[model samples]
Target: MKSKAAIMKTSGKIELGRRRAVWELPAELANLHHKVSIGSSCFLKLAPRPSKHWDARRAAELAVGAGFTLDKPCFFRSQIAFLSVTKIESLPDSVGPKMQTLMVGLNPSPYSSASRVPYGRPGNRFWPAAHRAGLISKDRDIHHALVHHGIGFTDLVRRTTRRAGEIDPPEFRSGFERVKSLIEWLKPKVVCFVGLSGWRIVSNPKAKAGIQPASIGLTTVYVMPHPSGLNAHASLKDLIGH
Candidate 1:
């Protein structure tokens, strides 16, 4: 009997025997040639290097954010290891014209990024509250909400973080401008911000929850409490109500 040899290829390279792989990034990716090591356990480990512009840990993030499907990297001891590469870190905007409402979140959490779903973190009350509020026909179904309920989803910032507090005010300001342009173009009936902190910094410092006087073109603006489980300020009931 003869043993079988297996070979696999992805967007990057896998060098046999050498236990090293180099990602052939496109020119638009700033010509990054990130290297990784294939361990005996069949895990891809990022090879550390000193670079002022690029960080090894962020290589996978950048790839996923650029619409590449890749496995997320995890920390193994002191080294960063990837089980596979096939998901995105940044959630894409799911808005379309004639949308009844556009739900804007603060940013993508690491959990949500790995799951490839907006507000997908298990502890996050967004889906549950939206379901209870009759905003979506199916729980955690973004497509169903958009198609059936006219509810769209987007984020103020596409960056993924463990906590929303990590996002800077400048990011919020810039993100708001982008959202404003989107609203102006899509012309959604209502723009609902799922986090008050972002709206407060971008639009009004003392902005309160609910419908605001501000309007992006003809779209109404509404501020809601953050649906994060860590946000004790607003309960699930309060989120549903908002």
Candidate 2:
């Protein structure tokens, strides 16, 4: 016996089998057959013919509509559109007491939100610079840094966006309050901001890279150029030096 293929309607809702699990799709993406599965992580598999319409941005929007966040979209060996998703809308702060340094970013991108690792995006130079700077023994391992190196990760804003420019000034101010509270409680020796933009908006509009004069509670603040590949002002060596 063969089970009939599930159908998605223009309303972007579909019920699956007896489990009755529902997924919301965009109108343009409707009528596609999707397979939803859960493992150590959750994945939404969409089987649509290869078309110019399907891209990473559209996939991200679809995932957001369904109350999920996605990593970089990929294709399975079978050429199916594979999207790994997290139910949470934003990346959670990875922090602990007895921290040497706390690294903060402006916000989460879809890449990091899905992987549950800050700066997990491939083109992002954060991990490489961290490794070169002797901050972490292993690359791209947040747990390793937290557990072994006494380094913690967090973000100024909990929102996830494709670009940091998409975040507004109000979010930065509110997020600074949250980060300030966290620092006062944890009292890390140093608080390192991966980008100057967020700190500049919230604390010092004219702030340049390196240690800032103001302290968040008793913690010293250090600002570094964003390690995003798109940020060409700083080179890999410059980031390592920071």
Candidate 3:
């Protein structure tokens, strides 16, 4: 990870704590992966009908609960309510005490959740940049990078969100508790926060990008810019440099 600390998937084997699972992506599921991993931020919002339906009044109330403003006439005219925040299945974290570095993100983007892979979103710069930086082979088999290369993955929050901006305060607080416990348990050599905002929220408010005087049990902590394309301050090369 760049910036001293930072943060999918390929088919091979995944190591979670002491357990190892055979990892493979079936070809048939590629369409769904493409939709969520590519379409979430750019377009294709969660629709209301498939999971839950809001009959006018309930939709408005729930929208407000999710922090959406109903004051605008143009807001959320589609059939789907954005309330499907929780994923059917949370992405599995790949972690172990023997790892050289543990990369942590703020949470799952809807795309990442759908694909069951960290930073699986096509819009994210993480995978490509890591390859460019020589952190991974050009083929970028994530399973090899983690199982054989001593890299691991995790998230500050377990929930999925269409946008990081939608995360409520309670979610962050609970997520932080879980993160601390994970760090204490694994004690990876380095714990890198993929986004500075995540570090700021759950960690020292004054901490900036790069190594910090933070530790969980024996693990060192650092912060870096998120590899999202939306973060303009850090480019692909810059991320590699970090």
Model 2 ranges off by over 4 Å? 1-87
lDDT string, candidate 1, 25-80, tens digits: 21122111112211212233343332332244344443433333444554433333
**Residue-level error in angstroms, candidate 1, position 220:** 0.3
lDDT of 2 by residue, 163-236 (tens): 88898899788777767866776689999998889888999999999999999888999999999889999999
What TM-score against the true fold does each predicted structure earn? 0.64, 0.65, 0.62
Q: Give a tens-digit lDDT track for model 3, residues 1-242.
A: 11111001213311111111111111111222232332222111322232232233333332222212233322344443222222133454655446778888887776775555678787788888877877667343545677676677777665577887788766776667766765665577888899888888876778888889877788888788899988899988889887
In model 2, the clashing pairs are none
> Sorted on lDDT, highest at the top, how do the candidates line up?
2, 1, 3
Scored by Cα lDDT, where does model 1 land? 0.63
lDDT, residue 194, candidate 2? 87
lDDT of 3 at 179: 66
lDDT of 3 at 225: 88
